[model samples]
Target: MKTQVVIIGAGPAGLLLGQLLYRAGIDNIILERQSGDYVLGRIRAGVLEQVTMDLLHQAGVDTRAHDEGLPHEGIELLFKDARHRIDLHGLTGGKQVTVYGQTEVTRDLMAARAAEGLTTIYTAAPVSLHDFDTAKPTVRYQKDGATHEIACDFIAGCDGYHGISRASVPGDALHLYEKVYPFGWLGVLADVPPVSHELIYANTSRGFALCSMRSEHRSRYYLQVASDQKVENWSDESFWNELRLRLDPEACERLVTGPSLEKSIAPLRSFVAEPMRFGSLFLAGDAAHIVPPTGAKGLNLATADVGFLSRALEIHYREGSQSALDRYSELCLRRVWKAERFSWWFTSLMHRFPENGEFGQKIQEAELDYLVNSRAASTSLAENYVGLPLESF
Candidate 1:
């Protein structure tokens, strides 16, 4: 089969990119190694930066997001037995984040693709890229135990961190930077009203905790745990008890607890692969970078990467120009590095580091104190949290 673009992932990045391309009269197909059900089943963060919401609207998939997604004007930072609210909307020129789940975003994109008859091949396994460095690029994969090949003008490697896209790049040609944190987040999703209207990020002598939500009725909470901690060791009661100990007295009073709908421990890490583009193959989303979830930048970064990638491809096909494509990596990395710095900084401020010792903890406390007390520092945090402006291609 032959197409203008072959996308090697059906995650939000690939699906959203496909929607954008299809609307532009560009031919593209998405290949996924997993079933659609499996993709939807994965739980993820819900906070959406303004740029992400804008792109979703651009793709004609924001009806549900705007209608159902909660708009948070601020986030609460808890420390020293008190809660400090950072007014994100007030600080960022009336910009606010929407609490829309990544799962819902994927669902919306998938539905749009199906409604428009766009092609997405689920269960396409053993995918491989060939000759991406040359003028002609091809994608090979296995479908129902049968090998198939697709010749394409361009390949979007949106297949994510563990997918074949990034791994296929020759080691000598790729430069990698990574830092794994000493802790993990033990997260729980429950069917209950959220503890607060807006998200709360807390730093306690015990550890770090975050109170977030998918909606008014579905709450998502996380507690920092040892990286080697086993989920099986913490029962629902124990999780709730530990969470309460870290929260402020008022929050703990109003906090609701219930049987967890889902529970898991995810290790924290910051990873970035320099030069997101490799010839005709361009990596987007987790294939190119990853951020600690403290700042909720993972999905947002992926959204931005594809927004740039889609526009670049659109200009190439419509105006017969390669200017945007040529500048894709440079433009993307500028934003990527900024996000990496923010996530790293935010994580260090909120989480406990055994190696940091007492002096490190004191420094973290001082930084938080300054961030909440200083208007400039608060504004800086708000701007980064809501996301910086997108670069026009």
Candidate 2:
């Protein structure tokens, strides 16, 4: 097979990148190692910052996203069994977040692609690259245990955190930066409704617990846990009991239990591969950078990356130039680092320190108190949560 662009992974970054290029009158191929059904069922982030929503609208795929998704004006910070709401619009002037699952967005994009007649080769694993030094670059893959080749003008390595594309690139040419936090998240997708109108990020001595969503009838919640903690070790009874203690209190009715849909543990870390482009290959999303889920910024960051890369692809194919292509890395990193900082700050703020003395806990409490009361602090959180502008490549 041959095309102008080839995308790997079929996650948000890869699928959306393919759609944008298709709209630009450029043909592309997406090779994924997983089935479409599996991709759709994977539980992940749902909060969409205003900036990401705008890009989806611009890409013409936001029709269903706008209709089916819920619009949230702000988030609530609950601590010491008390609730405090931050009016994001009031704080940031006009920005608001939309509550839409990652899986839903992927399903919408995949459906739109089908309507527009874009084909993806699912269960296709890349074998190797043929050329990047010539006028055409190529990707060779094995699909259904058979070998195949895709000739392309460039490659978008959208395969996520543990994928091979980022590692296959030469180490000398790549600069790797990483931060591994002391904690991980025990994320649960339960058949329970959210306990509050807005997401509540609470910091208790128990650890950091974020009350979020997968849908109205379903709630996605997470609690900080030991990095080695396994989901199988956490029983249904224990999970509910923990939820009741840390999340449910006398101020609010206890969280109602629903069937446990899924549970998994993911490490919290920040990583970025500098200069996201090498030859005809470029990295986006988790393959390029990862932020702790505390701030709910990973999906938003990937959407932003594809937004920039798709525009650059448009220019490269339209103007017949390499200038824009050469700058992909520098451009995406600007926003990537900013998000990393925010995610780290949020994680540090909500998680307790093993070395904390009485003063450290007091300081954290003071900070949380200020975040709810101070306009400047709240606005900073609102601006980052609602979204930051995408950089142009």
Which 10 residues in a row give candidate 1 its minimum summed lDDT? 352-361
The segments of candidate 1 whose C-alpha lies over 4 angstroms from its true place after superposition are: none
Report residue 58 deviation for candidate 2 (angstroms). Answer: 2.4
Which lDDT tens digits does candidate 2 get at residues 327-350? 878888889999999988988888
- Cα lDDT over the full model 1: 0.94
Question: Per-residue CA lDDT of candidate 1, range 1-393, in tens?
Answer: 999999999999999899988887899999999999999999999899999999999999999999999999999999887899999999999999999999999999999999998899999999999999997999999998899999999999999999999998999889999999988999999998999999999998899999999999999999999999999999999999999999999999999999999999999999999899999999999999999999989899998999999999989988999999999999999999999999999999998887888888788889899999999999999999999999997
Per-model TM against the reference = 0.99, 0.96
Give Cα distance to truth, residue 21, candidate 2, Å: 0.6
**Where does model 2 exceed 4 Å of error?**
248-254
